[model samples]
Target: TQRYAITIKRSRSDINDEIKNMTLGCNRSGYYRNRLNLTENSRHRQTSSKLLNCLFKLFASRCNNTWSFEVRNSEHNYQPSKDMSVNRMAAAGSCPHQILSTIHLNDLSLMAISKTIYNELYSIRQERLDSRTPIQALLNELQGSDFEFEYQ
Candidate 1:
């Protein structure tokens, strides 16, 4: 199975303010290391890993409010998962520590850990945008009003 990560490279932008570019890459597309780090004196256990250091990736750029995408590599060493959505849920929680046990027992990547954190932040951002607070409702109603006020 395969997973992916979304990475963004941004700079101070006069128009968009940020988000200069973005990338999507296979989560397993990197150096392979024996995470077990088994010492000579330590008891050995059979361990297996699915990581293949695949190089599949895509890139995107923004220009004048338009976005363009390009694929850097079209092939993967590992077979694609039958259900990509299942991989999306692989790191669905807010805390990396919550999955530490899984990481120790398996060959999970750091990209999956970061995906969990990003999911949390994205959920929070969506919640705030969809908030039903009375003040927020009032602001929504006043969005195109003729008055402007400074707000943090």
Candidate 2:
């Protein structure tokens, strides 16, 4: 079931902001992130970041639009867990480290999306402490390379 609420928080906020506060964004590009909940934060941050990268690639390849999103001020701390979200997020290219990488490509779409922003909570920064984020795998794959990506 979907639920909604309106609360006065001393400071003003809109529905979008309210939704952001209620849960970690389905995607990382948003005003604020739910920082306290490590389980949800990593779960969302990793999956959402990978998903953003996926979307960026999908759009860049099919269309010529330049997609970009700002980076969050803070970073995520990765800890090993037995949680189901971990495996799902891993498949989606969500890693704590290796947030960004030099693709060494001149394509406008990739170039625009790779450009970094400051003082924001937009997309995740790539820090590849882990083996490979989904972005790297996707980027390296040949066009039309088929692979299975899933969650749960």
lDDT winner: 1
- Model 2 RMSD in angstroms: 19.2
Models 1 onward score TM values of: 0.40, 0.13
Per model, how many backbone clashes are there? Answer: 0, 10
Q: Please write out the lDDT profile of model 1 over residues 1-152, one tens digit for every residue.
A: 34454344323344546676777676666675756677556737554444567877788777877988898887877654322232234347424454434544454333333455456556655666676775776677677687776555
Decoy 1 TM-score against native: 0.40
Q: List the residue pairs that clash in candidate 1.
A: none
For each of the candidates, the C-alpha root-mean-square deviation to the true structure, in angstroms, is 10.4, 19.2
Minimum summed lDDT over a 10-residue window in model 2 is located at 53-62
lDDT of each: 0.56, 0.30
* Regions of model 2 farther than 4 Å from truth: 1-64, 78-152
